[model samples]
Target: MTDRLKDFIENNADGFNDLEPSQDSWNKIAARIGHSEKVRNKKLRYISIVSAACIAGIAAFIIFFGKPQNQTDNFAEIPEVLEAEAYYTSQINMKKEQVYQMAGNFPELKNEMEVDLAELDTIMVELKKDLNDNVSNSEVVEAMIQNYRMKLMILEEIKSFLETKTDDQKNTTSYEL
Candidate 1:
C-alpha cells in the first residue's frame, strides 16, 4: 500500500508542486489563529484580576474583623503568664541542644536522661493545657515552672559530666604513649 502511495505521489508530483494556496487564504488562517490567541490572553488577564480582587477582599475582612493575638507558651488562652514562658522555653532549647551535642559521646547516659526529660515535658504540656482551659490554675502553673527549672538543672549537670568524661578520656588516651 505504501509503495502504491509512493508511485501515486511520484506520478502527481508536478501537479502537487504547481498548486499553492492564495496569499489571502494564508492571511485569513493567520488572522483566525491570532484572534483566538488574543481572546485567550484577555480571558486569562480577566481571571487573574478577579482572583486578585477576591483575595484582597478576604484578607481585608480578616484584618478588620480578626481578634488581636495574645501568645503564651503552649497556653493560647492565657495572656498574663509574665512572659517568663518565652525566656524559660528558650533556655530549655539551648540546654537541649547542648545535651544533643554531648549525646554523640554519651549515648547511654543521654538516652536514660532523655526518657525522664520526656516524661517531665509531657507533664508540662498537660499543665499548659490546664492553663489554656482555665487561664488561672495556680498549682499547674507552679508545676510547669518547676519542671522547666528541673530540666535546666539536669541539662547543666549532664553537660558538666560529659565534659569531665571527655577530658578524662583524652588524658588517659594521651598518657598511654
Candidate 2:
C-alpha cells in the first residue's frame, strides 16, 4: 500500500505543481487580512478613547467635590449653639443613664424610650446637615439647638416617669411587707 501511494503521488506531482493559486485569490486573502487589521486598530482606538474619557470624568469629580469639612469647624462659627448642644447632650446622657437604670425591669418601656430617642436623633441629624450646609443660617442653628433641647426634654420625661413608678413600687412593697 505504501509503494502504491508513493507511485501515485510521483505520477501526480506534475499536476499538483501546475495547479497554482490565481492572482485574484491571493489578492482577496491579502484584502481580508488588511480589513481585519483595520477593524482591530479601530476597536483599539475606541477602547482607549472611552478609557481616557472615564478617567477624565473621575478626576474632574474628585477635583470639584472632594473637599473635607471639619465637624467642629462648622460648630465653631456659632459658639452659643455649640455650648447649648454640649450642655443638652450631657444632660440627655445623664438622664438616659438614670432612666435605663430605673427601667432595668421594664424591657418594653426601655425599648420604647430607645425608639423615641432614635427618632429624635434622626431629626437632629437632618437639622445638623442643614446647619452644616448654611453655617450662617441662624434658623438652622436654632433648629439644631431646639432638637437638642427636645431630646433632653424627652429623656427628662422618661426619667421622671420611671422615678415616679419606682417610688410607687417601693411604697406598695413596703405596705405589703
Candidate 3:
C-alpha cells in the first residue's frame, strides 16, 4: 500500500510543476478585461443619458403643451349647457309657433292673443338672460307662470271652439232628421 501511494505521488508530481504566467500575457489579459469593462460602462452611461433626456422631454411636454388651458377646459365642459340651450330654444320656438297658429285660427281673439304671445316672447328672453347671468329673478318666474297661463287660456279657447262646433253639428243633424 505504501509503495502504490509513493508511485501515485511521483506520477502526479509533474502536474504541480511551477508554470508561471508570462508578464506580457498577463498584461494583455488584464488590458482586454479592463477595455471590455470600459466599453460596457460607456454603453450603460449612454443609455442612462438617453433615458434621462427622454424623461426630461416628456416632463417638459406635460408642463408646456400636454395640459389644456382653463378656458379650453371650460369650453369643453359647456357642451351640456349648449345642448340644453339648443333643446330649450327649439321647444320654446315650437311652442311660440303653435300658440300663434292656434290664435290665428280664432278670429275673434287673435289680436288679443297675439299681444299676449308677444309679451311671452319678451318675458322668455329676459328669463333666459337672467338665468344666464345666474340671477334668480322672481319676475322671470312670474313671467313663466304668466306664459303658461296664457297657453292654458289659448287651449281653453280651442276647446270652446270645438264644443261649439260639435253643438252646431248636433243641432243641424236634429233638424235634418
Candidate 4:
C-alpha cells in the first residue's frame, strides 16, 4: 500500500506541488489540531504543578493521619523496641546534620546521594501499624527494626563517603600555578 501511494504521488506531483491552502484554511487546520505552542506549554506546566501538589498532599496525609491507635498491648517488646527506635532516631538526626554541613562543601554530591528519608519513614510508620494489629508477630517487629537499621546504615555510608572525600582533598599536597 505504501508503494502504491508513492507511485500515485510521483505520478500526480505536478498537480499537487503548486497547491497552496489559503490562510483561512491554515487557521482552520490549526484550530482543529489546537496547534498553539504557548497554549500547549501552559497546559503542560499546569498539569506538572498540579501533579506535584497531589503527590505532596498524599504523602503528608499518610505521614500525619495514617497511624493506628497507640495501645501498649499491641507490641510485645515495647521497651526494647522503643529504646532501639530512640537510638536509631538520634543517629539519623546526627547524620542529617552532617549531611547539611556536607551539602555546603559538596552541593552536587549531596544532591546526588540524598535519599527520600520521608518515604522510608512513612513505610516505618505503616509497619508499626501492622505490628499493632499483630502483637505476637516477630517478623513485623524485625522488619521495623530492619528499616531503622537500613536508614542508619545509609546515613553512615554517606557520612563516611563525605569524610573520605574531604580527607582525600586534604591529603593531596599538589597545586598547579
Supply every candidate's count of residue pairs whose N, Cα or C atoms clash at under 3 angstroms: 0, 0, 0, 0
> Ten consecutive residues with minimal summed lDDT in candidate 1?
54-63
C-alpha TM-score for every candidate: 0.51, 0.54, 0.34, 0.51
For TM-score, the strongest prediction is 2
Distance (Å) between predicted and true CA of 161, model 3? Answer: 3.6
- What is candidate 4's lDDT per residue for 29-68, written digit by digit as tens? 7667875544443443444344334444544454455555
Candidate 3 local lDDT, 73-146, one digit each (tens): 33212565457446555655666565555444445445544544464455455554543443433333344444
Using alpha carbons, what is the TM-score of model 2? 0.54
Among all windows of ten consecutive residues in candidate 3, which has the lowest summed lDDT? 68-77
Ranking of all predicted structures according to lDDT, beginning with the best and ending with the worst:
1, 2, 4, 3
- Cα displacement (angstroms), candidate 2, residue 99, comes to 0.8
lDDT of each: 0.62, 0.62, 0.49, 0.61
User: What would you estimate as the lDDT of candidate 1?
Assistant: 0.62
Measured with C-alpha atoms, the lDDT of residue 62 in candidate 4 is 45
The global Cα lDDT (0 to 1) of model 3 is 0.49
* Deviation (Å) of 67 in candidate 3: 37
Q: Which stretches of candidate 1 lie over 4 Å from their true place?
A: 1-82, 174-177
